[model samples]
Target: MPIIQFQLIPHTTQDGLPYQHLRFQITTEDGLMEPQDLKGLKLPENVQWSQGIVIEGKGPIWLYGYLVHECHPSSWVGCYDPRLGIVVVSSHTHAVKVGNVLPIQLPA
Candidate 1:
């Protein structure tokens, strides 16, 4: 498996703290699915989605915090890191199992 890197220039807060984005894609048995199709898909636990996506110390450490923030589907108003990874699809939008798959969307 290869690591799909999403180049995210960390957002500088007014306080000068850098906030990184967590972008990743889910890997099914077939391969990495299209980001648009992720909204309503099912992913097994054995799926190799992380692979080389997350390389510790390679980028900003705050990306983990962004991942945690994005994981919560209730807050559907945040920016989706245009990377290859999972997303939090809200039950309010579709009839999907909340944890079925992570939402992956390319930046528009």
Candidate 2:
């Protein structure tokens, strides 16, 4: 399995509301895949979006907001098979910066 590196980028909306942009990169046998950015994901209020997390197959990865969210939502960002080196983000957006240095486990 490849290493999935995740980052949360802080940004301000036009209305001045604070939110985070989620970005990730895959490190596979070939090399580091291009970073993928996922915008407009509604994260939980308790999550601190300043740090990055890495998921290395210790178990399944789960996302949450008010409820348990899907990791690959059809509307936000599509599902990708990291082994194939194919990255899929929404057609309207492009990949953003690399993530933070901290390594933490994603919420189960």
Which structure among the candidates has the greatest TM-score? 2
lDDT string for model 1 (1-108, tens) is 332333332332233322233345433455444444434333223322222121112323354444434344332213333362333333333333334333433322
Q: TM-score for each prediction? A: 0.21, 0.29
Write model 2 residue lDDT over 1-108, tens digit each, in one string: 335454544543233433334444444555333323123433334444332212222213332221123333322232223353112232222322222122222222
- How many steric overlaps does candidate 2 have? 0
Instruction: Extract clashing residue pairs from model 2.
Output: none
Model 2: lDDT equals 0.31
Error of 2 at 55 (Å): 15
Model 1, residue pairs in steric clash: 24-84, 24-85, 25-84, 25-85, 87-102, 87-103
Model 1 residue 76 CA deviation in Å: 5.3
Native-referenced Cα lDDT, model 1: 0.34
